[model samples]
Target: MENELLGKFKLVVGMEIHFHLKTEKKMFCSCCADIWEKEPNTVVCPVCLGLPGALPVPNIDAVKKTQMMGLALDCSLNMKSRFDRKHYFYPDLPKGYQISQYKQPLCIDGKLKLESGTVVDIERVHLEEDVAKSFHEEGKTLVDFNKSGIPLVEIVTRPCFRNIPDTVEYCKQIQLMVKYLGIGEADMEKGQMRLEVNISLRTSEQERKDELPKYKVEVKNINSFKFVEKAIQSEIIRQRELLENGITPMQENRGFKEGSMKTVPQRSKEEAKDYRYFPEPDIPPMEFTPEYIKDLKTNLPPTPYMIIDKLEKEIGLSRNNAKTMVEKLGPSYISKFEKLLRMGADPIQTSNLLLNKKEYRNVSEEEIIEVIKNTKTAYSKMEENELNAVIKKVLANNLKAVEDFKKGKESSVMYLVGEAMRMTSGKNKPDPIQLKQKILDMLDSDAN
Candidate 1:
């Protein structure tokens, strides 16, 4: 009965991600793009403020970066493309419409394949200018145009995501790609990269026939991946109940409330006609030759997928382990990992230390090599039964910590391991890495 109910409906999701390009100036003007930690309206100019007689001049560097990004995502670069004005009104948008690309975007038909082997199709990757920052206070609103004209790129994906894990992995891979290519920081907390999800639920028959639900709920401007996951799950339940009650869910825009982890109604969603998109008259159409496109492609750097392959084949690391290293440590630390290997550090131990111990990343290569040697020596001298006895004692003493570890609080296991280390002193000390793994093993056995 449970399996029958579970297979009754499928979740369909598509994502629109807006990321700021790390350019020196704004998209359409000569204003500073580094608006972080700047005063309100300090970086504004006539072009960004949308004042009378103000005209926009396209930033050549931003255009190049967008093309570079398109190449990185395996997108087809359009030989000739132009900007368009998208009509929208808000306190933050000083201009009646935003300068964005519509009918003809810079790149199209790109795809990103997740580690799980799910390929997400990219519908379009367009260029645009960011709006100003808005702050609402007591019965009043304030606007800062410092971020108004920063270079922004929007990546629109087809509605192909069936699960949250695949969706989140796709987002992480995009972040990794941007970092590797020096495009943007993609720091969600600082609003460098923002995520918007369009989700709906389909019946089993509809899914089998490759059909889409009529109504989709758009969760906009989500900052964290955790919130994205929660919002999707919550919206699924909300829509499912509506269907069960013989009512179709309304198509609308919603916001994710972090406090309660729920999606609340915002407004009716807009269609293409509502935006009233048109080509920008101020800037001329962009043209790229075959040679130019080829040059950009040839100068492109290696992607995360290439690095993951190297880790697996050359370094002999497992696929999952290599992925974790690249995803967490990022592109900056790839050289450090390679250098440590040249310094005679064991591959498995070096990988473990870098992944588990945050402090180990800051030390010199010589210091890291020495620590690995010392840890091995200490681990070999320790008796297996003695280490097990200490770990068991730690677990028995800290019942709450053990319970927390079982509940998926991985940090709790570290707390238990620390207690075991405290119990044994000096020459009898067990390797912290081995101690953590043994503790986890013991806990898993107890659960079974």
Candidate 2:
């Protein structure tokens, strides 16, 4: 919204996400997948390095995982998909051309629904082998083949996002979905998941309806979700400025600089000639039968969005809170919490106790049940206001700490709450905030 230069242009965003599979060994080799953290070149084998007389065999587990992921995303599973060579010259690529899918991908024609009820269509989900990582420092660059030949699944989405928030939400939702499906860890910090954003701007409906703009840009190697959001916002502003000055944004690749929160030019956008992609001769075409696809579909987990909606409707939880709780606590924990709520424990209180309050540490659920059973007799006798009054009195006596909270030292309120709970023997029915305010008023009266 800050970008005002392009005379009202609509921002469009698409993402290509690559997630490394959590497997024991490399895609085509027996070498361990632990190479990512190991010393450089130590985990590499002849097959991964594409040495002479070495042949590549597809990893069955990796293939099954890709199929399962496809099923979870509601994608069409291709019975057969062949590996192609994406030829390029880079220090990291040991084979010189990556073994990837071109014409035939593992999955196609999928859609993901966002929280806003918008569905982003997925173009394809393909399988490939990851290349080695290159480390550059000082004056030289070094190649680490430890990560070479790891199994990866690349998901490409259609250009559908209209703003920064939508793009971010889509990425986060997809990441969660991938995690829920048990496909991959999808950890951006560990390089297990990476993102590439393709962005373009079009003139608004009211402006220049006769001709559409052809200016487009690609931001590559955006690792973190925060960086993806920031880079898109920065690029939108940058392109708008250029267009305002009667300049069209050129088609090119840009790198995101985390420190400065800006995008820097990396290289010109390459056409098909740049990659020189061809059929991979070293690997054979992989085929899957109908039974194989059906087996994978049976193993697919429920999508995170679906789970969120069910939890909200069935458990009477807010959508956002349920999503957060389910994500943090996992499905098993959520079920336990729901059971406790059904047994007459207050829902909000139960949520807070499970998530925020750590007061009953080291106590088993059985012990909690026992305590609740004994306390309910005394607790139910008093009205809510009367129970809250006892809590307020306990917090009011903690004068010094209450003063700290009133002076904007808000973190001090925790100490007051803890003390109040202790004084009331955890029997008070008042909310934490009411106790804190009562303590502040007592302090003010004492000062007067």
Candidate 3:
């Protein structure tokens, strides 16, 4: 297991992440963009339904949100952009073509940081329309056009991932960013987000540079990040085995099977020409002023990566603690905690109080600060009498654990301290060091 067995080969991955936008209307029509709420065909309109002479009118909010996402990623927002029609025929696509940004996208040249410290380069973040919902029942396929015209942002990442962990971390960071921006929930299970991963392996950097394998396996519609990692790892092993047997892995689409944690072949991959892409006639090219881009960058929220990094590096918090702060409190929630620290709250203790409380969720900055200030003045620590009563109650509940402590199971006292903390609803949780010593003394007193 030298070098984690990854030294022999490089794991190259590129990802295309589709995130549904939170716009109120469909991308090209005035139909309800809330894809999950209405009945089938109720959200459809003439424009979205692709009826003859029913022209499209783009939703301006969707464009602005994409620009916001670009600024968050440090992407270059183009002053000029336009949409194109990607020709394809399917039962769900009433128009037989998809209107998406092809040549002139709204954003370009970006990067996202993983928790592992590796940076994944962004190829583009382009606007596109979503396809309809497809259902297979009774061996027949059914289509729902209600979801057909929803706005979507396709985030394309470079083939920069070298490990399975980095890929998953990168995906999570993006998901957190989207949720923080209030664009959408980015819930993969609800089909609000979809992932397509491009994976290939090379034995040497030189060989990769010469011709970084054109053939790649694409795992599409991965509903979860854990499954994304599992699928990539299994595909890597499959490719290595294929190479060892002197067979070339064909470029194709694969699926992750939940039961086996293995990838199954889906279909032969489509080339760019297969779609017959052309400029979208129903929409006009777009142009933005320098002032617009500046305003967008100014209004963008701090990315999750920066928040976690600051919490860890500047405040001396553990990586897990920082991540928890962002996860529970949200990307913007860390700043409120920082404000409390500035008003004379210990970082570690303040984080524990705010983060571990059941009754103090989503509180305002002023309220949190007031609560912290009051706690500092009211109880320096738990009163000695209250602490004893709490410990006695904990021991009384778990008589077997008390006997176990007397029988040389020293770890049982800490367990009792945990029970006391639980009994107090985590409001007066004491330092474990002091609690453990006190509990041991109580056990010794009972024995004598």
Candidate 4:
């Protein structure tokens, strides 16, 4: 089936994502990269400012973090990679050029598999220096050099995406990966992660008579994932309308307007010739030996998918719970919860405590495991008198909850179970599931 709005064409989209690396300083300068929390222009240095005499020294940690990122993406580590001068002139670029990779990138040939079984091929992951942010204030624009020269990584994907949801999912997956890697925050609100969507309309599979589109229109620097999705969908519709009217869409760079939910052209697309890319004389080529890449791999954490798989397989966590754990919690938190699960904690209860509440932050792992142990021990069928006595006391203490439960709010029984657990002293504690069933039987008997 084809989209009726698109007529004879199908959508093809690729994304270029930029993430600010979590390095301590600028990519090629000693200036602190922690300027996000600082006032403007205070975090600049001569090297970051691109003064005539100043030279750039590469950040080895940034390179290593990039390779670690590559390993997490299942990308092949480029043993030999180098940086080049991407010459361009903009108010934000003090150097009138950017130090980025062109021919040889740091990582190559990776694949990101979505949960829906769609695998998008990664073209390359390259290292680069960030440009200063431009702020348009009242009657004038301001440039903040504090963010200039921050270490950044650019991931380019092949044009394999055909729908909006898959594209959004891929973006989300990458955000989770970088956060888990601890390489970058990938925070969209902070301008840490940016998305560039390249999309074009091509003839549908059944409509082979129509000519395919040759030019790609890129919507760049989308700050939010929702906007990125909307921009792609809007571009598809816009391009299809052009083709239907017998006009070819122009190749241009565009920006997403949130108020209108439309993509407006920023500038006509420029070729590599416009930038005149060449080798950067200030920085030398980066070459990593087998031992270095191997060492980098050791520091890399497991991918989010792997962590999700482990949680689901080992603990019998629901798919949704596993996804939440992998996306919301970092590698350390996931590892901690996995250890507790291995210690025989109930997955359902532990997962509930892990998320949807912040109180677990104050609870220790030992304390959580102790509760699980007590619950398991307490559910071994106490003497009938003791069980009935605990239930009676719990029901008495939670009369409102009892009434609510009898009045068809079944969820109130869990509150009564908490009371029953509180009534049991010592190492014995009630499992909410088992206690709820016992209370149900007791209430039914009273009714009869």
Candidate 5:
């Protein structure tokens, strides 16, 4: 279904990702960064609240995190970076203008390679202070400055994506990269990682250039990857219908209506001149030495791609299976699995129990090793006759599945084998291959 949709229009996707840095204090104030389920307004201070006579100070940890992210993405780190004021009018903007980087951002020119081997170029990565949260109820809106001055690193990517699935995978790759860097948790549920998707459609054929493509539509504040894909898909369909009806697509900001799976226009696209960006006088230009960048590089964690390669090459697992396992188990959890594999368990069985089943939970390396060892020991101890007897009892108990197997229902064999294993308390005393053969032989005898 997705490929059929992609066949109609060329999807161009660019992402603006806002990642909250893990710092102990607000960007320009002494307020605690840890928001730990406190009262709504308790974490605010004079600077964060934008009171009179308040001053702003840059957080060093936030700056370093921005630089580290730049390096991780293979971006050119700017030795000198400065802040600017982005003018906007909203209740969430307590200071009236957001202190952001405009002319000189911390990093520029980075690239990320997706699992599909497609490379996406990053336009730039800049450091900025976050805005406060807004709560609206009963037609009245309230602002909380608790999150106003938190440090944020915005990563802007080039508009090079081809499809909705590619866009979703790109977002996931960026989140994994940020988490591995230990700069932020990158949890979408916590608003730690926020996404703004820019989508435009072009002709599927590369050579047709008689007319330009539709104007890009921006979808703002998409918190989930699933919603990102849905928004793009809907937008592409909407634009296609507009063009087919002899109506041109408009350049505007749209909000993804989650419940309805449609997009509603918020406003027309705003240019940089509309923001009225200007350098801030209060803070001076910040600079970093080469030694600082080198030190940060040394401390960087292994990225998802690197881990995927190691899993496939060193552990002898298929690429698709490794990627699936790594995503669900996390890097640390996969490390524990690797340790168990080294202790002599069947690789395929371990992968199945961990990735292919839903019944397993909180599995430990020690427990896995013990289970494999016990199963091997039990199989060695039992004679062929004893194992055959166990299989016969299980077949007699599960007559329905046995009859289904005799009728050439292949799936029923698994249920019968599982019943046999269960009846013996997982000590059926044969390897899985051998156990299957014994069951087939018993079924053949029953037919005779």
Candidate 6:
């Protein structure tokens, strides 16, 4: 059903995305950061466990990585930034408060342009420590401190999104960008990243374009992009219904219910004042020189946009195919792809093997070349006379496909080529493109 208030109200959305940094140690302690495979609570240390007399220390590498992402997003980096204590009480939080940035965020004023050409404005990119993992079973709640103190970077965007598609695309681009930067894997399934949506609807068409609604609803801890899209749509409907009845929606934190498309209220959304933010006393404020920031920016890797462009323009892959290759193979594997190209491998064939052939994805450059060579050698071994005979037999077997090809359905030629391949053994089948041309030539001869 169409939104009852589509034209009467405007949708304003912003997002707060938190992702773990691929640092070697915890943000405030020296505990190992690779706790994904470890037993719950086993990786905990005094600082991460919030034990008495333990002080927190900042991870310099995590700081740099956060700034690196800021630079990629065209944000201004602050030479002076500090961690503040955000007080809250939850089972997942070992510390009564989380160390986060409130006032002096590391990066600010960035924008990311979506594929549809709509630009989303980023308010600030800040650094913070993540909370522990919480699992609910039956009527009880369990907490694991293994995830506690893990370095997290939060990207806050302005209320710029007006639709769901652009919002989803922005999240996808952010994922790809993080991988390209080698900062984080951003695997949502593995808890490396999480998404929160801040959404509201303006009640009046007469409201200024830039004016926000009196109330907003926050949907928290959404793990999947599909869930994000669904949650946003469901919340829009829920809020619209309330407004339609002359009732204002409450400002609150909500969660997408598991196995369903609906959102349920979690709590009343807390403003900054409720957090009781204060600077961390244990860790000193971080300060960097312009020269240091400049050096880090200079050494940054290529963005996902650059990789996709190269794959499409230089390697002759379609735009959609190029994006798929980048997403599946990642930017780190670009070197291996270039090596295959240097060894005279076809771009389209290599892309297909990498994407569809699971085993080929991890094979070395030499193995890929050998496979391509063997395919070529097999096609060459089939004598022209024998190949022509095989093609004729395929045409006879699939007369309808041949007829379609004759009637200008060029796609039918591929069907006949597959038939020809099946009619021969391991070393007798020709390369698909080469076989197609020969089949076309034979069909032309019969027509003449």
Top-TM-score structure, candidate number: 1
Q: Model 2, range 1-448, lDDT digits (tens) per residue?
A: 4344334787777889899998888899999986546777899888887677888888888988887777777899888788888888788885678888888898999987776668888999999999988989998999888888999999998887776767888888767777777767888889998899998777776234644357568898889988998898888888888877889889999999998999999879988777887777877777888887777777677778777777678765555456666667665566667677667776544554565545643356665555455533323446555655765675567667766765547687678767765656443545564454445444444544
Q: On lDDT, who's better, 2 or 5?
A: 5
- Score candidate 5 by lDDT: 0.80
* Pairs with steric clashes in candidate 6: none
User: Per-residue lDDT tens digits of candidate 3, residues 172-266?
Assistant: 88899998888878888779998889998777764557557657899988999988978887888888778667787899999989899999999
- As for TM-score, the candidate ahead, 1 or 3, is 1
Stretches of candidate 6 off by over 4 Å are 1-7, 137-140, 203-208, 373-448
What's model 6's TM-score? 0.82
lDDT of 3 at 336: 68
The C-alpha local distance difference test score for the whole of candidate 3 amounts to 0.81
Best by lDDT: 1
Q: After superposition, which runs of candidate 2 have C-alpha atoms over 4 Å from their true positions?
A: 2-7, 206-213, 331-350, 358-429, 433-448
In model 2, which range of ten residues has the least summed lDDT?
372-381
Colliding pairs, model 3: 84-280
Span of ten consecutive residues with least summed lDDT in model 1: 1-10
lDDT for model 6, on a 0 to 1 scale? 0.86
Which ranges in model 4 have alpha carbons more than 4 Å from their true place? 1-4, 205-212, 370-448
What TM-score would each prediction reach against the true structure?
Answer: 0.85, 0.80, 0.80, 0.82, 0.80, 0.82
